[model samples]
Target chain A: MGVNTSGAAAYWNLERYAERVAFVDEQGGICRYGQLQSQVDEFRDQLPQKRQLMVMVSRQTVPSLVAYLGLLQAGHPFLLLDEKTPAEQRADFIERFRPARLIDATGQTIESTLLDSGLDENPTALVEDLALLLPTSGSSGVAKWVMLSYDNLQSNAASICEYQAIVPEDRAITSLPMAYSYGLSVINTHLLAGASLALSSASMMERPFWEQLREQSVTHLAAVPFQYELMERLRFRQQDWPALRLLTQAGGRLSETLAKAYTRYACEQGKQFFLMYGQTEATARMAYLAAHREPEKVPAIGRAIPGGQILLADTEGELVTQAGQPGEIRYRGPNVMLGYARTAQDLVAPERPQELATGDLAVLDESGVYRVTGRLSRILKMQGRRIDLDDLQHTLAAEGWSLLVTGEDDRLLVCLTPGQNSEALLQSLAGHTGIHRAYCHVFERDAFPLTPNGKPDYAQLKRMQHESAA
Target chain B: MKAENQILNTLFTQSLGIPSDLVTEDLAYNSLPQWDSTAHLQLVMALENHFGITLETEDMLDMSSVAKARSILEKYGVEWV
Candidate 1:
């Protein structure tokens, strides 16, 4: 149960618990721990050594996990591309990463001029060796690949398992995209603990999704805030999912109302609801709210997982120890990534061995709970005024309104649910924040656009806003 | 007169939620504002439904630009003039 010194060795140890279930894909196919290991070995034998491989997979599929494990076992650094990424983006990725080969189960077959190198017969990676190159979700703009090591992933998985008290037989459902750090972490931690995974390709809105969860007896569910919004819209009742035992949400803040509602439902159902917060840089989860305490202390992202330390520092980088004071959330842990990948130059020099200065602004409450305010980089300056779009959106969301804010050509546009008084909402926001009306414009839509990962599609939103303004 | 062009026009308009007039043979998917990943999936489904043929995954990925889409559809036996 100590920190795994090697990815392959850790997996080998976990395979001893191979009699336990490992994964159940959307097609109801079951992969036991032993079977998963065999597939990983098989995939490793099929891969080339010392060359980059691009894994293109649907979110939460068994093949995706197998491919990742295989790449690690073979000591080949791999890039994970979400199936939902456009072909244009994939082409761009192929060119930039120059992956020697691509493995896809999503049926995407790309032919590129990139060199195809032969596979290695025997390859191995140490715990400290690079394991993966994951691209940041980049909901804002251009995506950057974050380099992660085997030790980074192993430490984070072990810490998560320790925090959750995950057991061998626990069953988890794959809800988020596996290409995402949050979703991939769920697989790594669960499998590390010899748990079972139920994969369902259906979206949250689909009828088959809930039915599959109930049928598969999914004990753990990982989701983002948008899916929780859909669950609320569906008015999912506690009695409907008696088999559900734990629910975790991350990848953006869950609204206070939905959090309270889900917490109450979990409480009534005698299930645990975990409010988790993390980023790709941390290799998944850094902080999690314990399941027993929900709704009453809802906004907090809870405490750090084992082996991780979260400290808040003011704008000047001085550590803030006082509760309720906002500062940049800096993380120091083995799980923090090495650094980001640069297209033009060699990888940026790694940050000081253990600490990562997360760009998020947050506060630690009296209970030692962390609540993210906004990203420091997300702040926009327009017409001599500074604005935090996240703050503006959060304020509107608190009042039962949903909006996506973007700036195009020096004009800030607020995209909200259609037919609501756009001007009035803007006026109210201005009244509350003292923002000038001329600098802000409001556009209404029936539904705000969302990425496949369930985050707001700000890139697409900005484009639309620009076209409309033109 | 080409089935490939018809497929492209229909998919572009229907999936991207753009007017038919806006879709041209030279119009790239990302060049238009509304044609994003989500819309791309919708476009794929539309193509499958319209052609009554299951698109190979490779072809689906290759259908990025309108011209690329026409070529891919031609491989599927949909003729393009």
Candidate 2:
């Protein structure tokens, strides 16, 4: 890998691997590495001469892929957002980040806008090394993004390739959104390893997705916890998909029952099931359970990757040395992000310290594997989307509602303060978050239970929820 | 409104949080912000519970639009009239 003068990594120079297959679209259309390089080169040539900040609504398509690679090759830092983001959130992003350009695509046609008031006229300064920006929270419409330098992407990709033993012959499918850090890492690692990818927006629930998976002979498949559950319900047969050599699960904790089932299935079928733990702040992955140890079936996140250290710290910020003691998972690695960009000005800010506080509580087992116990943050991951409860509360407050909100995965409990229109509140909450109304349980409470310190008693709320259900 | 149409309409509005007016035959999954992958499963479960039918995986995936959902329900012996 080579680093150019403008801080972009030259690893994308795919000329030598000319005849190699780089991409296979949903229709089984092939795009060789040579053609990919030419497309990227042509796309890059059309961009502005000077590097500019951009916002791209990334999709699972060959054109979107080319745009991303083209932007990176041109040394232009761009914020990658999911195409599913709401119109209001997109507007908020443009207003907050002040990106010079917006790149979006419909089907295979790339649409771009070079804002008349781009950075040139009202320039919000950006660090020279910032190569990418990814939202910490999924389509939650939060402005917070993890800032990554070219080094962060390169290092994480290398570590993933080393751990997974990725080879050029391996082929992966775009099962997850490319805007997601985990999905983006898959693309990065495969490209760096000279492997190939199949680009498709079709989800696993669809028959075409399975047909394509079998047709493409995809060797690698990565999914979140929700998708895994769906696979079980759909009675997905592992033996039928013989081409699947590597199966990775992340995004959130897979339920105990599903975890055991998948682990046993992998062991019996002689397939690899790598349970990985990661966050966007760390660029993508922090730890993974090894495939060789698949038979253990214990809920463990295994160990840190090469060149990374996963340490645990207690409430007082003291290191937890003894096994079985729970503490916050802290990681120190080159893959750690430069810092977060909350507003336009923060884009040019200096990098934070190298250490990353994962806000996840876990314990080290006797076997040296880390098993997550709980989350210290008020964040819920509903179908791979990270929703910060406190942030949602703030959004509600801004809309003139006072509500006590809490919930586990797939369920969000919102206690409406008395005298508020319950119907109006429910619709507002559902509409604002883009979460299904069915997932929310809107209850009315005259007074909420509070702790001695005056904080909302969430445990009491959970009890009330169960009681109401009964 | 017919009892079955009302039931279906209630399911769509309640599960998706969209108004009844938006629950047209052309209204499709993934076309609305509220009816994403997360909402899709919840809608599936709601329809099953309300209609007292178990949808096969293929039918669940193929039930993309409101019209398609109605046809799938019809296949499972639900009357549209």
Candidate 3:
């Protein structure tokens, strides 16, 4: 997709990283960067049209990536639908995007929905500067598209590689979904650095995942918090991976306990654990706490990534420079997304401001680290006092409990794991807040509802809480 | 044998947190969303707790389907019908 001239040039040179092992598939198929560029060239040649907006359902990592590059080469602004999106939601997105073509993993057009002659009178002109469109979950729990230019993708990849100290020798695995920005970032960074990747769609819950990791000898893998929880439940440390050198976590807040536990486990296994923080608006990563830091630093999102700057802004929009003061996180970087798009017309607009007001509230410590206190919306008013649910959840998670918190105006409801009995925690929560035990309730669930991006689905939890209360 | 079937049936449903009606003899791991890797571990734990026998890692890997679980448990003297 043709973007601003400087941004377009950044993406135009594909052969710069044309030779290196990109990754191995489950069937022992190896993909190289050179081969990847060649595949993109081949696929672009076979494309039915040029510079058309296409919606694609990703398949296995390698194939999905090839088509992604193919779209870039063909100058088509593409929307990558989450592979895990349910059929109904998938239908909703396809209907909304109104792409010229809907392509499956195998590069086959599922169907052609040719728009009216006047719709996007110049199809390619619509995205002359936009290259990627990612789905972001809005505050009200709806999927909204975020527009990213070629600069956003390349700069983010370069910035990630810098902080992570990724090299051509690194072998990262596809532990996360390719459709999501984090997973896609891993692929991009590795390919950009002439490194390698190991692709498997099998989840951490399956045995094949372990088998594939062992056979391929992946040097690193990225995971969200819940995937770490699942691994902990399965006694992940019981097995050793001699080949693993790094473990990265992001997508949501990982509890201090889990973070420390994994950090220790990685240390024991002679590996580094990277705790990262990001949003799709920032193109996946904003900050990352590296492995060599002290254990206390594990809870902090560390500093902004190499090229990015983090500043705290209060309600009046003044910068808060004093340490220990909490305010909204404001991030400034080239990796920030161009803008957001709720409708197709929005895709054609110019870039948004490079500064992102990351709605997460954070306090900067004396050590130049940013510790997220809670989201601006996560504060709860209880018994004439304000309580941050993120704080409550953090405390609970730090105490080795898997949980979610929801509430009404007058009461609070906390949900824990089905097998865990939190009677003591429940009693303490009631007493600590001066709220009567009757006003606070504790329940359990087998699993918390997760959004398509794998974070806890607060919308679903709220519905369930009210439905049960009623 | 009847007692063993009763025990296994209870174990599968309870461990996987699925309805008893859904725990058919042919029900396999990964067949249902609920029967994931964690559920498999839970099932193994329930089997160990109920039968008073520990399974090797290979046996755990082999325990993908209910029939396979039954067969493995029988080796540990579960005597399922």
Candidate 4:
């Protein structure tokens, strides 16, 4: 079955099911899809014509979801801004996007008067039109706005549902922020399947969160690698989640050891652990490793999901058909984003409009399973030797140390929590990589800097490295 | 010599990446610019390392400030001047 073809009509159809529990917020307030759709219609009736909408929402599930769908139905290309974003960053985003309308949940609303003036109430586009503009996480550098069409999102969600067997009866918990592609996809795919969603915005470390998961009988739990590591440290045994049928990890690579441990736990408890891989450019998930085959197949990101293809290409851009050879991972699918919006040019430039050359380097094993080696951007050239910081981190982790390695133009710094011998780790890294210990600086930090999404904040690490070097 | 004061001083300085001299007895944890949740975890880790003791889950949550950390450490036989 296809998603509703007409945007307004499809939203109205979803409104009929609003009482069935569409979303539960962090405060435990539940909002039905129908009620949310009504809110969207109301906002649409009040929105101005020929103007963009910028929404600033907390990681809260319900309001964010409502704002997202409402903007889409209104045919306005809305920007999703993280509520936790620093005030300076938020100001920069507003200046860059120059959105005429802003929907903020935290404080008094700005631009509400402009929207309430009723500039345009006519629906200009169908549900198949482009719905939202998202800023790429840009972990490597400056962020860019990505335009994702309705067809792009719908096709991706349908493909995800087909591959994961997501059905109407299945329930998923929103673990990540709605501003992120991964979290947003969870909401879309689950809603598309007409499934229930248990919205709990609290971090996994919060005590009440675990209780809510059990209380809600959440079957599917999706999280980033950091959260999984936290779970490992917390000793989140299989027995702790008797009602959880599936657990998914993505947003970054989960350490092989932790993946193995979680896999073992899942097997003993008769649960499935899915190791997924994807990017915001692809609208969330592109590949998933089935639960029963983890750790042993731990490093493998598995094959592509329905409607996606993973191909390996050499540095020369030649297709690397040989197995176990490293190459840049490329994806071709309907879900590939329309293109990035260039604020400077005031134009959307579609990169590889048909195929996305995901700058991630990976190897296709003999069994056709893909293992991401590292990002091309992550490669650091130090003393005439190219080094992947991720490789260095994995090597350190193998030696029983958790470290986050970040590189400046000329120097590389490794940060680790206290209790790990910094000198010993540096020596081990030098001994293993044949790089001299002088090239590495070790900092015994209390914890690695994390982004709002819980991933390591490499940019902040780089800044810290620069300051320390100075 | 309150153990809480000593523990608070060390934890506030180390976890928040501030100089020991900056962490006064009257300083509140949340009131500091750098003493966010991440710094709180660092302080906990540093205290755990310094005292050679693992804090209980409840204690970890309650030990939000330097003063509270000191009191929590006292329960583990860590005495301050």
Q: Against the true structure, whose TM-score is highest?
A: 2
* Number of clashing pairs per prediction, in order: 2, 0, 4, 5
B3-79 in candidate 2: lDDT tens per residue? 45777888888777777899998998778777766667768888888777788888988988899988888888888
Q: Model 2 chain A: which ten-residue window has the lowest total lDDT? A: A1-10
- Write the residue-wise lDDT of candidate 4 on A1-470 in tens digits: 12334443232246656667666655666666677667666655655556344445546555556666666655566667666555666666666655556777532236744333122332232123446767664222235767777667788888877776877667788777777787887777788777778877666655566667778778888877656754654556734776788888777667687778778887888888888888777877778888565456775789898989989999999999998889998898888887786452233334437888877789888777888877677755433234667766776686788889887434578888888777678657654443444456777667788999999999888777668668
lDDT of 4: 0.67
Prediction RMSDs, each to the true structure: 12.8, 3.1, 9.5, 9.9
Q: Tens digit of lDDT per residue, candidate 3, span A1-470? A: 34434443343345776666766888888876677788777777656564667788886566677788777666677788756555766666666667777777777655454532123567755757687788764111246788887778888898998887888898888887677788888888887677787888886756787888889988878887656765776577788788888889887777678888988887777778899988888888999888555566777888899889999999999999999999999999988888887667777665688699877889998889889887667755443234556666776676677889766545678877777767676655643443444457777678898999999887688787777768
Over A258-362, each residue of candidate 2 has an lDDT whose tens digit, in order, gives: 777877877777777888988888889999987446557356888998889999999999999999999999999988998988777787775676799888899
- Write candidate 4's Cα lDDT for B1-81 as tens digits: 235445667656656656698887556545654564445555666777777888776676566555666667889987777
lDDT of 2: 0.81
Steric clash pairs (candidate 1): A48-A119, A49-A120
Error of 4 at B68 (Å): 4.7
Better of 1 and 2 by lDDT: 2
lDDT of 1 by residue, A54-117 (tens): 4454555666677766666666666776776667667677666555667786433344556332
Q: Can you list the residue pairs that collide in candidate 4?
A: A7-A127, A18-A34, B1-B81, B3-B80, B4-B70
